[model samples]
Target: MDTITHTLFGLTLYGTVDKKEMDKNHKRAYLVTAVGASLIPDIDVISRLWDTAGQYQMWHRGITHSIFVTPLWAALLFLICAVLFKTKDKRLFFLGWLAVVIHDTSDLFNAWGTGYLEPFSNDRITFGTIPIIDLVFWTIMGIAFVLSKKNKKKSPYYFKMAWILMSLHLIIQSIQGFLIYNQYDGKYDQVALSADFVPWTYSVIVKQDDTVTIFQDNLFQEEKERYVLVSDKGADLDYLFSRRPEAKTLYEWSPFVVVVDDGKRLGLYDPRFYREGQSFLYEYIER
Candidate 1:
C-alpha cells in the first residue's frame, strides 16, 4: 500500500477504539502508538542514504517490514510511550503490535511485495491481488469518516464496519485475480499479475522462453493484448551491470524482466509495469 493509505489505516484503527474513558495523556499515547507503528516500517526508505552497493532495491521494504521485526517495533514504541507519557499500560504494547503487524501484512497483497520473513527468507511474497492505491479502501474510509462525524456516539462501530468492508474488497479482488491468473495456467512458462487501480482489472504478464506478453484483463470484458516483448537470450549483461549497477538490482528485484539488447543499447524492464510506450521501472545502459 502507499504511504497515505497506511496513514489512513492508523487513523481508522484509532477511531475504532473507544477512548472515551481514557485520560487525555493516555489518549495521546494511544494516538501516537497507532500513527507511529503505521509509519515505522517505511523507515527502511532511509537506507538509500547509506546504500553503496546499489542494494537499495532490496533494502527498501526489506527487513524493516518483516513480521519478525514488528514486535520489536512495538516494544520500542511501548518504551517511548512509557518514557514520554509516564503511562505504564500493558495494553499499549498490544495496540502497537497490532498496528505494526497490520502494516507488514497488508503490504503482501500488492504487486510490489515485502520481505515479510526477512532474515529467515529473502523471498518477496506478493499476491498481486490489490493495487498499490486501492480506491475502494479510500471510499470505505471516507464514508466511515463522514458517518463518524454524524454519529459521534457510534464512531467506533462505524470504523469497525469500515475495516470489515475493506477486508471484503480485498477478498473479492483476490478471487477475481485468481480466476484471471488460472486462465493462463499451462499456457506460459511463467506468469505475473499487477492489479489495476480499478477493481477486477489486472495486467497479466506471461513469459515463454524469450518472448513476454502483456495482457489487460477484466472479469466482465474480454482480455486485450497490450504489448509483446522479446528478450535477446545472448545479450551479455556484464558490461551493462558494470556501467549501471541499478540495472542489476532492478533485474533481481523484479519477478521477471523483458531484456532488450540491440547493438546500440542494452536494457531490461518488468513487463507487468509496461505502460504508455515504456515502463517506469526500466533500467538500462547504452552500448
Candidate 2:
C-alpha cells in the first residue's frame, strides 16, 4: 500500500479505540502509537542514501517489514509512550502490534511485495490482489469518518465497521485474482498479476521462452493483450552490469525481465510495469 493508505489505516485504528475517558496525555500517546507504527517500517526509505550496492529495491521493504520485527516495533512504541507520557498501559503494546502488522501485511496484497520472512528468506511475497492505491479503501475510510460525525458518541464503532468492510473487499478481490491467476496455470513458464485501478480488473504478465505478453483482464470480459515484448535471452551483460550495477539489482529483484539487446542499446525491464512505452522500474545502460 501507499503512504497515504497506511496513514489512513493508522487513523482508522486510532478511531477504533474509544478515548472519551482518557486524559489529554493518554490521548496523545494513543495517537502517536497508532500513526507511528504504521510508518516505522517505511523508515527503510532512508537506506537508499547509503545504498552503494544498488540494494535499495530489496532493502526498502526488507527486514524492517518482517513479521519478526513487529514485536520490536511495538516494544519501541510502548517505551516511547512510557517515557513521553509516563503511561504504563500495556494495551498500547498490543495496539502497536496491530498497527505494525497491518502495515506489513497490507503491502503483501500489491504487486510491490514485502519481505515478510526476511533473514529466513529473501522472496518478496505478493498476492497482487489489490492495487497499490485502492480507492475502495479510501472510500470505506471516508464513509467511516463521515458517519462518525453523525454519531460522535459511537465513533469507534464506525471505524470498526470500516475495518470489517475493508477486509471483505480484500477477500473478494483476492478470490477473483486467484481464480484469474489459476486459469493460466501450467500454460505459461511464468505468470504475474497486477490488479488494475478498476476493481476486478488485472494486468496479467505471462512469459514463455523469450517472449512476454501482458494482458488487460476483466473477469466478465474477453482479455486484451496490451503489450508483447521479446527478450534477448542470449545477450551477454557483463559490460552493462559493470557500468550500471543497479541493472543487476533490478534483474535480481524482478521475477522476470524482457531483455533488449538490439545492438543500438542493451537493457532490460520488468514487463509488469510497462506503460506509455516504458517501464517505471527499468534500469538500463546505453551502448
Candidate 3:
C-alpha cells in the first residue's frame, strides 16, 4: 500500500476506461489524479508527523482506506472534478471510485498491512503474503507503461497486460498468506526468505538471535541476521513513481539516511530506528 502501487492502479484504471480521450494532456492528468489519490489515503500523515504520531495511529490509513471512506473520497473527488473541469461524466466518476476501491484491494497483500475495516477495529489487516513490491512484477508494469507512452497505438494493450499481471501476482500472494496463517496459527512471523517461505519484496521477517526476537521488514533477504525495511528498500517510492515520471519529485525527500557506501549501492538506515547495535541493519542500493 505504498504510494506508488495505489497511484498505478488509479492511473491505469483511468487510462483503460477512458481510452478515447488518451491524449498527452489527458494521460498527464490521469497521472496527477492517481498520485493525488494515492496520497489522499495518507493525509493522516500530517497530523501524525506534526502534532503527534499517535494521531495518525488513531486515524492514519484507517478511515480513509475503509469501505465507508472510499465512497466519500470518490464523491469528494467527483465534486472537485465537476467544479474544476465542469464535466459530470458519471462513467469517469465511477471509474475514479473504482480506482480507490482497487487501491484498497492491492493494499490487502502489502507487508505493513492496512485497515480496510477501521473504526470498527484498529487492528491492521494483511494476508501476510506479498512483499510490498516485487521486482519482476514492477519491471513488467513499468516496461508496459513506458511502451504505452512511446507508442500510443499499443498503450491500451500494454496497460491492460500490466494491470492483469499485477493483479494475478497479488492474488497468488494473498492465497499464500492465508495458507501460512492457517498453518502457523500466527505463530510464525508469516514472512520467510524464499518461496519455501514467500518470494516478495516486502514481508515481516522474524529475527531471533539467542533470545531477542523482533519483527524486521524483509525486502531484500540477505543473511539470516540481515534484513531491511520495506520503505528502506524503496517500497513506497517504487510504487508511486513506477508509472508517472513526474512524481519522482515527491520521493526526493527520503525518510531514511544514507549510512555507508559499498561502491555499487549506497547503504541506508531509517532515521526512525537508527541507534546503537541496530545500526547494523543499514541496507545498500544504488540510487
* Candidate whose lDDT is highest: 2
Candidate 3 — worst ten consecutive residues by lDDT sum?
A: 207-216
* TM-score of each candidate structure, all chains considered together: 0.96, 0.97, 0.63
Model 1, 11-90: lDDT tens digits are 99989989889999899999999989988999999988988888888888999999999999999999999999999999
Relative to the unseen true structure, what is the C-alpha lDDT of residue 126 in candidate 1, on a scale of 0 to 100? 88
What tens digits encode model 2's per-residue C-alpha lDDT throughout 148-201? 999999899999999999999999999999999998768999999999999999
Instruction: Give one clash count per candidate, in the order shown.
Output: 0, 0, 4
On the 0 to 100 scale, the lDDT of residue 32 in model 2 is 94
Clashes in candidate 1: how many? 0
Question: What is the C-alpha local distance difference test score of candidate 2?
Answer: 0.92
Give me the displacement of residue 188 in model 1, in angstroms: 0.3
Global lDDT scores for all candidate models: 0.91, 0.92, 0.52
* lDDT of predicted model 3: 0.52
Model 2, runs deviating above 4 Å: none
Model 3 alpha-carbon drift over 4 Å, by segment: 21-34, 180-183, 186-287
- For model 1, the stretches where C-alpha displacement exceeds 4 angstroms are none
TM-score of 2: 0.97
Against the true structure, candidate 1 has what lDDT?
0.91
